[model samples]
Every structure is written in C-alpha cells, then in structure tokens.
Target: MATTNTTTPRPGGRSARVQAAVHQAASDLMALRGRAALTVPLIAARAGVTPSTIYRRWGELSDLLADVAVERMRPDSEPADTGSVAGDLIAWAEQYRDEMSSEVGVGMMLDVLSSRNGVSVEGRLPVPCQCAAFTASQIRTIVERGVERGEPVPVIDTVMDTVVSPIIFRSLFGSAPITSAHTQTLVAACMKTARLLAPVEL
Candidate 1:
C-alpha cells in the first residue's frame, strides 16, 4: 500500500531563529561593509550559522540578499490614512524617509540595487513579493480617501517619482540632512502641482 506523506510544519521554531539571525547579519554586513562585498562566508560568520547551511538553503547570493531585503521591509503596508490627502502624504513621506535613513535601511536599498543590475533603483522596483499585496491595499486605501475628499490625486508613480524617490536619495546618498523642513517643502510642491492638474468643479 502506498501512503501519502503528511507533515504539518510549525513556524517560529529554531529554524526561524536561524533565518532571522542570518538575515540580520546580511543586513548588517551590507550596511557596514557594502553590498558588493557580501559573501556566503562573511554572512555565515556574522550570523553564527554554518556556511553550508546558508549555501544549502539560499543556493545563490542574490537569493539570500533578496530574501533579507524583504525581511527588512515594514510589516504593514503604508501608514494609516490620516483622513486628508496632504496629511496622509506628509505622514507617509516622513515615515518613509525616517525608515530609509536608518543604517539598516540604507543597506537595504544597496543590496536590492546591487543584486539586480540594469534595474532602475530610481524609486521604482518590484515590491518584494511578500509585501506586494499589503502595499497594494495601502495604496488603494489612500486613493479611495482622496476620491472621497474630492481631492486631486496624483498617480502612485508620480508620488514615487516626486516625493518618495528624492527623499530616499537624499537619505541614502546625499550629505544633506533629511530634516522635517526639507521633506515638508517636498510635500508642499507635490500637493501644489496636484491641485494645479486637478479638474475644476463647475
């Protein structure tokens, strides 16, 4: 008689711990050393896991880097809608900058870009698969709110190009402070343009 294999796996066990540790190590190394310098031995040494374990599980440098990138992302999609488009926009922009400015955050983008050459790191990249659905939901919520408020909503790509990308570039690459004043100015400019492009009610 042939029997089908039935095994229910439980998460949050030792394997989970090892994954987390290794992931954190990868982020740390990318941030401190530089993404181009990463290697399996280096990650294993930092993570305290055997190099073979990493090799067996990830198989390739790009795979592990991509996995760590996703793990480092915010668990929630966008922040809560603040009931107003400007309010929501500013809040989201500030939060996005703050997150990216952190040491780990800086490295996150580097690893992402380094791993995928020829892909524009210009504020447009594939959303990590795990968070893709959640991020979509968040954008929908923000857009729906704009519609209700009778506000002129810029396309999501526009926001990324104008608001998100600039701030992230400043935080990650530039020397200037990503201060509140700087981000506020950005928000104001985008909001003004959005209003200008919006249709006037008769």
Candidate 2:
C-alpha cells in the first residue's frame, strides 16, 4: 500500500483533514491504478491514516468512490451561457469530453458504474443515479433557456442519448477515442434533432 507522509489540517479539524485525505487518496489511486484496484485499505494507506478512519467516515469503499466520482465530474466552473443554444451545447459537450479523457474522471466513472448494483468499498451503490439526473437537469436548463429566447424547444433525451451517452459508452468499452470533433458534431446534430423532436403546441 503506497502511503504519503504529509498531513495538514483543514479549517475544520482532524475530521475534515481526514475526510480530505481520504478523498485525495481515492483520487490518486484511481488515477494511478484503474478502478478495479482501488480499495479502502489502499486509500487509507495512501492518506497516512488507518483503514478504520476511512470506514468510520465513509462506511464503505463504494460510497467513498461514488462521492469521489461526483466530485470529479463536477464542472470546474459554471456552464457557459454563450447566448446561442448551439454554442452552449457545444461548450457543454466539450466539458464532458474533457472529463471523460482524464485518467481520474474516466477510471472512476467506469469503476463506479460497474459496481452500480453492488456495494462499493463504502457498502453502497458505486455511482448515484442522481449524477445522471443532475446532468439531465442541466440539459433541461439549456432547453428552457433556448425556448425563452425564442429558439425551438429542444428534445432533452435525444441530446443526452446522442451526445453524452456515446462518450461514456466509448470510454467504458475501450472503443475509439472520443475526440473534440466528435463532440462538436454530436452537439450540432443533437441540437438540430432536438428542435425537430420537441413537442409543438397548437
């Protein structure tokens, strides 16, 4: 078990530092070694804390991994409002592409979803379905904003199915690289398809 010797306190206290350390360890491990190798004991060892500390804080490895997955997927900055649905969608797709390409992001997502039905190291669902739901919500926001601006209402699911799903699918399957051009094309096509699919009011 590779372990780090440095320890620093967060503003809160020992508990905060412990939690931070645990997450840091998880991220580092997942990035260095693919998801299958990430374990609670390994994370604890990396953090220079006892395995009991991780268990006490997160209860299981899965739970910790899930939280780590969510944290990794979270956008570094708010979604860009580019004043055009096409531009906005392209920006969103690019962000997703960036995350999917990173070692931490891609590895954690694959591991978490693989254990979706099983207990994580924390003894819970590896990935929370809410993360997907939240992503859908962001799509909805983009659609609603477009409608308000007099752009056609967008088909939320179609966009998600076409653009977002493929990236994850390809990453997990070890298929061809999902390049920037692929993301741009998907966004453009989805935006057009969404307009056609949106319900038209009388």
- The candidate that wins on TM-score is 2
TM-score result, candidate 2? 0.70
Q: Residue by residue across 1-202, what tens digits does model 2's lDDT show?
A: 1101112222378877777788889878866986789888899999999998878766777778876665555444445789988888888778777777666566667555644434557866535354565566667667767877778655777877898898878776755658999889888777666552233430
Cα deviation of 24, candidate 2, in Å: 2.4
Off by over 4 Å in 1: 1-50, 60-63, 116-140, 195-202
| Residue 131 CA displacement from its true place in model 1, Å | 8.6
lDDT tens string, model 1, 23-84?
A: 88987887798878999999999999999999887777887886677555634344557888
Error of 2 at 179 (Å): 2.5
Kindly give the stretch of ten consecutive residues in candidate 2 with the minimal lDDT sum: 1-10
lDDT of candidate model 2 versus the reference: 0.69
Q: Clashing pairs in model 1?
A: none
Top model by lDDT, which number? 2
